[model samples]
Target: MEHDRTRTRAWVLHPEIKSDEQRRVPEPALEEAVALAAALPDLDVVGSEVVRLQRAQAGLLFGSGKIEELGERFHENEVELVLIDGPVTPVQQRNLEKAWKVKILDRTGLILEIFSDRARTREGVLQVEMAALSYQRTRLVRAWTHLERQRGGLGFVGGPGETQIEADRRAIDEQLVRLRRQLQKVVKTRTLHRAARAKVPYPIVALVGYTNAGKSTLFNGLTGAKVMARDMLFATLDPTMRRVELPDGPEVILSDTVGFISNLPTELVAAFRATLEEVLGADLVVHLRDISHEETEAQAQDVETILTSLGVEDDRPRLEVWNKIDLLSSEDRQATLARAERDPAIFAISAVTGEGIAPLLSEIATILQGARHESTLSLTFAEGQKRAWLFRQEVVRSEEQTEDGFEITVLWTDKQAARFAAL
Candidate 1:
């Protein structure tokens, strides 16, 4: 819709197409769509519904009768925008806008809008621009369907044989090319920064989860950085990193990443990948979950699926954070804590109340410290290089001189141990 001072009244529709092989439970899905609508700055969501259908129509998506009925409702409410919480074809979008007499946005467009509003960094803005351009490029299809088609002609004949669609596509392509170049420069700068961070000995722990899953809150609690920890979806679009020295643990760089969602737009999946590169390079990944949400399990599965799609290896070190336990009932909280305690990889914590944080931090420290048990090393007197290296690394706990060598005890991280081995 129009970006102005006045709010755009919007309606949300989640189509539950029965013919589709994968179907989300409609009610929560509808709620999520409404939340997505609410995420935009100028959109005021007035009403929402879960529309059940045997199948989606190819041209208009909804049936004629249904369209007319919805049109009447829109007229009654003065709805300026209709947000369909699914993939709407360009043809269907055009036809529905004609029938409903209002602007229509599918799931992708709405997400793109929210991201556009939330992006603060220059690189983030460029990425969003590129993604929105790509989406608009695809939508160029049906808008020019009614334009005059060019027939066979020479370079100077028949008005150069160029149709409106081709011109529009060409303009969008040019815009995308320029945006890509700008984005590459920004990315290169970030790569240089990442390289500098790489030289530091601190390990990186990345926070990743579904939108509004308390990742930002946990990140703030751990690092003491005042990141935007709002309840809104896609609240944090750009990555924020901070150094944290854990209690009785090694120092680490904590990275807060943009949250994942179900059915993310493919364009964004590619465009925003650069922002998530921190996750790929992190030494420890913490998958935070809103354990209090009704559809928590489903949301966790969606996050897992996205992580796999992003090529996060199965062998990567990861921890499951069951956050927001303060929102749970006392009994459920106890049960969750008990369950988490049973699994070393799972931690139940309330980032708001700071409950269970000590244990989680201790665990992170334990993991970052590599093998907890100290290793004994036999170094001959002639092996002064290795002996001096151990002392320089400050991992030596104790040393004893024997007849021909020295016996040393050391505590070190896996990375340090590996470096020593390489030397």
Candidate 2:
């Protein structure tokens, strides 16, 4: 197609070959992608169609005949970009772009692009760039725009061909190492801050949910912070910590983190682990859900899967928050609420209207207390250092001194309890 480089059209292609599966791609996922794309300010989606291609041409991705047909269609429709809803090998991406004479983005590449566009914070941007560079290290051949060449590192092999590929890989490896080190520094700093907070030991409540499931909105509603609560995927990429007061007059840090998605890229999960450590270290995890969506159950499953993958499955206190209840029909909402009542951890509420949210916060305050360990400690008055240590290490509600030893009652987190027991 002869469109301007800035003016591009997108086509979502789903290859349906001879397979046991009924459909090459699920219709709902495609519809979701289209809806997501329509929400984007840039990049117009001109056409979308499904096609069947020979499995024998898997390496090049599409048969030569199909390539010619797609090329003709693109030309006729003035389409400039082809968005494939499946993974495309670097060779396949290059071959298809060459044959079709248009820019091509596979599912992974398009997702990376979306993340690259959405990321705002320094850490978030770095994580996305790291993923992009890792993905680009392999596709060094096809990504070469002449303009980018002028800027350097243009193609799969910028200047030295395959040698450039090795160099790019090495560069990406170094960058990843650096990023990890930087994130580790951040982690250490956070740990120190958490240690300082441990002197008071207010409970921490973490919000974790599927992308666009209204976590940020709920967090803002609870904390009264304008933390960019937009209705977009990964709107809150950076973790935001805010103090929220409960009905019992106790306040806690409410952390809002990056949203989870189905088939979330493993590389991203690993890259963003440092940020997710807040969730792992939280006193309680609030799993938000868009109760109105048809895929609410599936989305809940996806959130749990991601959390389990992150290794927070066992013993972490969790609460289910069925958000967006206002979007559901009255009957459906009532039925869902009835079902939710049967689950011990589940609560249905609209984050917008604050329905059922006060009780949820009260429950959180109650659960936060249960997450701690109550212990009575014995220490000598001579061991004032130990008393100071106990104060520093555990959340002591009261203390008393004895000739034999000083007995102090403390509420500790799991880790702190372990430390106190060891001492």
Candidate 3:
């Protein structure tokens, strides 16, 4: 469907709440919020500001004076939507919308909108819809009188209790159940596909990083796949995979996954778990970092937090790819290169320029080589499926046919061995 070219005039506000302990600079946070708002199609970010607050007001979020000031600004700008850079309670959202006479979306809601717009695959679409419904369920705060009605009933066993909000919530819950069932089917298909890949015995190299961290750029550069590499945040929502050949090393499957963000909404985390399981199953994780960003360290920390939450093992093989070196000044670039040189596990490269990629690929090949092992095994004649799967994987170096079965020698990674065992 074609989107309207006339964009929605939107204003973004980053609440610099003094009591909040996050270390992100308010200016960068506001800038990120603006970028996030811009990521949505047909959104013209009219203005953005960091609203400083000594403390948050339970009902309004901001003080009366600040609210009135922002309200004036919104009116002057004719803002159609207000994007908050942090969480806004439903009460605060309702009060602010009433006060400013514009729709308000908190950080979570804005991210959900972006995900909803970007989701492509069946699983991704279903996940986004479920997450949006889950979020909308919380916002059913009698925003409309049509949603405030109570079903007629006696005041006894089945009293006049179920309000419109309750009914809506129930309906949403029902939809969620249905979506979950559909999602499970999609996940099952994905699992079968993953199993098929595992039978190929290719070491999986997963790319993970903060949004707009040049992961897709590096992925395209490395795998030569024309994935949607863009400057926008969350540009690649669906996980993409391609077989990549390493220099003088075994061929491996490289996966580009959804980007991570600081304070990613709980709804997205829960909804995208199936997508993220690819990372969990990976043989090696390549963390791509935009070293040029001022908040690079903080962003890396956020990625770490998300990975930890996803149960990525500390001992998992990982390499850090410090990307976007082209964006840095000469001196800073030299410093980054020097830092990377001192660390065997870290590589500095500009994905856009293809600088330092050859060495990175060589390093990846070396790591995969170290992880590979050769073994011999025998399968009974009854296990013809397993025998054919081995041959299809081409892992069988030599095989001898016997009356009962076939004896085979194969080369595979530990992950592959475990998967075959499970099969």
Please list the C-alpha lDDT of all candidates, in the order they appear: 0.87, 0.76, 0.87
- Count of backbone collisions within predicted model 1: 0
Q: Poorest 10 consecutive residues of model 3 by lDDT?
A: 153-162
lDDT (Cα, tens digit) per residue for candidate 2, span 93-165? 8888878888888777777777777677666777788788778777876355444334344565445334444
TM-score of each: 0.84, 0.79, 0.87
Q: Give the local distance difference test score of model 3.
A: 0.87
Model 3 clashing residue pairs (backbone):
none
**Per-residue error (Å), model 1, residue 389:** 21
Report the candidate with higher TM-score, 2 versus 3: 3
Worst 10 residues of 1 by lDDT: 144-153
**Which pairs of residues have clashing backbones in candidate 2?**
140-155, 140-156, 140-157, 141-156, 379-406
Off by over 4 Å in 1: 1-5, 142-161, 371-423
